[model samples]
Target: MIESISRRKLTVTQQLSASFLLVILIGSLLLSLPLMHNSNAPATTYLDHLFNTVSMVCVTGLSVVPVSQAYNGLGQLTAMLLMQIGGLGLVTLVSLSYYSLKQKMTLSDQSLLQSALSRSNSSGLRPYLFFIYKLTFCLEGVAALILMIDFIPRFGWGHGIFNSLFLAVSAFCNAGFDNFSTTSLTAYATNPIVNITVAFLIIAGGLGFANWLDLVRRFKAYWLEKPRHFKLAFQPLSIHTRLVLYTTATILLLGTVSGWLLELNNPGTLARLNPFQQGMVSFFQSVTMRTAGFATIDYQAANKSTNLLYMLQMIIGGAPGGTAGGIKVTVAALIFLLFKSELKGQKQVVFRNRSIPQALIRQTLTILIFFFLALLSGYFLLLITEPKLDSFSLLFEAISALATVGVSMDVTPNLSTAGRFIIMALMFFGRVGPITVLLSLLNKPEKNIRYAETDLTIA
Candidate 1:
């Protein structure tokens, strides 16, 4: 029975992986049409179109061509739709559709939804789906309103409103696809309104739906007048939620301060800005590092230390079940705690006074190893494909693609066709995950024979 269930789960994960690939393929075809290109812009190759589509659908946001120059109004709109669908998993949209039609979800559907959303269970799936849609739109609506406050006056109503809508969705979805073509958030680097609004949107989206739902429930319970309700309200957050929140806050804080310090004297990036502007850029980049791909300054022009810093941040990425991608903040935190515990000679790994299962630790280790291997393999392949590229930037690009954090050092556009294809594969694997891809290809075979345990030596 247990083996059957494991195989079933692996099947579900495979389905999810296949679903994302299909979405990207369809999106690429749509984007490759001649009608999608701007009138004055040069026609884009199918490979470029495929790369862009995968980047957008995966919500990684790296592009070979500047978005404004590569596509017309129609292409831009299509890209936005793809970003929304990708950021919110396909299962999420499907569940919403079923709820809208007043249809019940089958057991298989529930299992897929649970797996996609990384939820603990499928109880109250409908309400959760409803909440996700409501929260997403609400946040995007507010972000758009705030962004329009500045864009409308400068670009006029039509362009301003459109830009506001696109950016709000991009930020909230952590897609990082800026229509600005050239400058990105650099133009608004010192603008408190745009920076603060976008930062909030990125952080909120990266928090994951589960965290928001838990926070809302806890908040409502705390305000309840009934003793029973109050008692429920005062209950502490789940270990997952707490760990995500704590680790996210710590990452943002450290990233911001470190980025600011590293770039303070470098005239190429932040040194020219005023103190306030520098601080804003620092804070904005920090929020964006593990999540969105928006940039206020040219990261390539920054000091080597800063580039390495950003690379590490991108590798860590955002929380699971959120729009952001990476190994996930929780996984990284758990690994840290595990290492700390081991160093202290403890047998059982514990966090927040709760013991973590050995299975989870093993899972984290497996993911880390997979991530490193993928990064290393991609780096070597990229080197062979683009022999003239710098090793540091090449490695940075590989890691960014694998983590699905789309910040680039200007190397992506110059890559060979093979390099681009390699990146597309990395982005897809990163978005879905290494384990999911592996499981999608393998059959889980059950072994009935038992073997005696053997001890292995380790350092």
Candidate 2:
């Protein structure tokens, strides 16, 4: 009986892990269709299809081919649909839609949803799932409508509307694929309407789904409903939300300032732009570094300091349960909390008046270890495959792709086939999650007897 139970558990875990990979495989096959391939270009290679598939499914914006020049409307739409599915998360979306259709959610379904959304098993899962679906679609619609202003005049009514919708979805999903590769939005870099609109959409998307819902619930109850004085009940923000907002703001401000200072004198990059343009580009770069992947300036031409700053931002990506990937803001915050507690000689890790479970702390450390290992392993592979590329640029590209941040230093397209494959695997692992993937592959331990306690000395 025990052996059978263990086997069933292992099987379930394996199936769960395979779900994301299977989706990526299917997406790649569909995108590789002749109609979806660039009409004016050569036949698509397996490597190209795989890389694009992972990038889209992961919602990471790194692409070897210029999106506008490479694929047709059908292809771009396919990519956008993949991004939408990825952004909302496969399991969460399926569960919410299932519930909306008046279907019952099974225990397994609830577990998957909770894991996907990073919610506690004891929390009210159904209502939260519904809120996530409703809030995400509503926000995407608003962002699309706002983006149409700049898109319509340029691309005309039909194409403009379509592009606007696509870009809005892309931005809000934190997928940085743009339709303006030929014209390259370089013309509108200074346009406040375009820049600010994109920035807002990106921020809204980067802020996790839970935070969006929490903000909405509180706003409606406090302001719109106008409850009795001294009876205003505000929903407290979760520790995840607090960490995400605080860390995101800190990274963005620091990244912007550092990018500006580093590139202000670089004649090839930011030197030619006026102060207003320079600042706008700097701010956009800062925002995009956190998994949005859009770039106003050529990342390759960016100085070493700017690239390093971006790598840091990519490593500490958006909040949990959001489309954006990385180690996650909460994980980073927990690490800091753990460190602070250690310094203060506290017994437990606490933040925002909430105590973090010890399991979560261990998980965070494991994630950090896996992340660094994946990054370093990918970098080393790249070094072997493409010896000509500079070490820093290669490392930046590896980390960006691994974090699914999509802020490449422009070495993506130039990578050899082997190098691209390595990145494709990294993107997939990063998106599906390091812990999930690792647990899926490992065997469950059998408990027979307790081991004798022992202590080891360490520095």
Measured by TM-score, the strongest candidate is 1
For residues 199-284, what per-residue lDDT tens digits would candidate 1 score against the true structure? 99889988989999989887876766455655455357778888898999999999999999999999988888999888889989
lDDT by residue for model 2 (1-459), tens: 112112335444444455566668888888778888676965567668778778887888888776677678898888888888878766666666677788776565565566667664637888887787777778778877777887888789988888887888888888887876743355667788778877887788878877887777666666665444444344355556667777788878888888899999997678998998889988988888778888776777778877888888889888776778888877778888899999999999987777888766877888898889888888889999999988888998888888887877678889988988888888887887564843543334545798899999986
Best by lDDT: 1
Model 1: residue 340 alpha-carbon error in angstroms: 1.1
RMSD of 2: 4.2
Worst 10-residue lDDT window for candidate 2 reads 1-10
Error of 2 at 340 (Å): 3.0
Ten-residue stretch with the least lDDT total in model 1:
1-10
